[model samples]
Target: MPAFTIVTTSATQDSDAAEVNTLTDDFGSETEALGYSRRMADEMLGLAAQLSLDFDYSNVALYDGDLLEEDLDPDHPALIGVWVLDEEGCSYVPAAEFRESLAEPEA
Candidate 1:
């Protein structure tokens, strides 16, 4: 069984409702999972910015066009984080802080 799970969610804004998509990946360690989360978060942020969506972590959305854009809530589905699976159950690390935990201390 995998030791960790990485979950990513994407949403396309619509007139009255939004289309949400979710994907999950399994990894063997927290380090590996966090590395993936950081990269994925960067890519999503880039995409949002390329579409001129502000990427304010509370007002950005990605669409299916060549590069669609819209305003999203703070709980935007741009990038997700890793979930640790243990004997008890699972724990989530929000996307906003996933990379922080993995960062190297500065001198």
Candidate 2:
């Protein structure tokens, strides 16, 4: 098993930063992986729009567990990592605070 750090970048600060949720087996190829990730991100942006939420991708980083070898089986690879949606004007809220907010419905 090998660990790989996946970081999603945005050309502008207004883009959404989504963690790669599901990586396919064909991701072994660079082109395939990039395309897959891009599509996933696009879908996420679309969802955000539907929810009337603002998404920003100023920076996104993931630290995979300690593992070496780069080219491994994509189907049975290590951590796929998680994506936390970062919204503008809401960065001050910590994870705990965000959870608390979720407990109450918006008025």
Candidate 3:
């Protein structure tokens, strides 16, 4: 099974907070991540529309095990790798790309 790290950012009372979480449950390829990201983005978009919140893709990120070191730089501008998996009795999609692609339009 491929390992992945999930980076999440949340708005706080004073500022923003970022954290990284690692997962080895499934996922074994980039393709899986891409598909998963798309689906998640779609769902989040729908939720935002219903709640009238500014929903964007920057809220999520996925990292590959190779990139998920104990001392990963938080300011890096590259994607951390993620593994994709294909199991006979399970299905999952990674969502790293969706977060990376969330950019506001230029004024």
Best candidate per TM-score, number?
Answer: 3
Q: lDDT per residue, candidate 2, 1-107, as tens digits?
A: 33344444333344544333322242344344444444555555566667776655422223233333343222223434323345522122333443455578979
- What candidate 3 gets wrong by more than 4 Å, as runs, is 10-24, 66-78, 81-107
Q: Which is the winner by lDDT between candidate 2 and candidate 3?
A: 3
Compared with the true structure, what per-residue lDDT tens digits does model 3 show for residues 4-105? Answer: 555433222333543334333347675675556445545544554576554222234455554555454333444453222111111222335433433435
- Model 1 worst lDDT window (10 residues): 58-67
What is the C-alpha local distance difference test score of candidate 2?
A: 0.40
80, model 2: CA deviation in Å?
Answer: 15
Off by over 4 Å in 1: 1-3, 10-19, 56-107
Best-first order by TM-score: 3, 1, 2
**Each candidate's root-mean-square deviation in Å?**
14.1, 11.7, 9.2
Clashes, model 2? 1
C-alpha lDDT of candidate 3 relative to the true structure: 0.42
Question: Which candidate number has the best lDDT?
Answer: 3
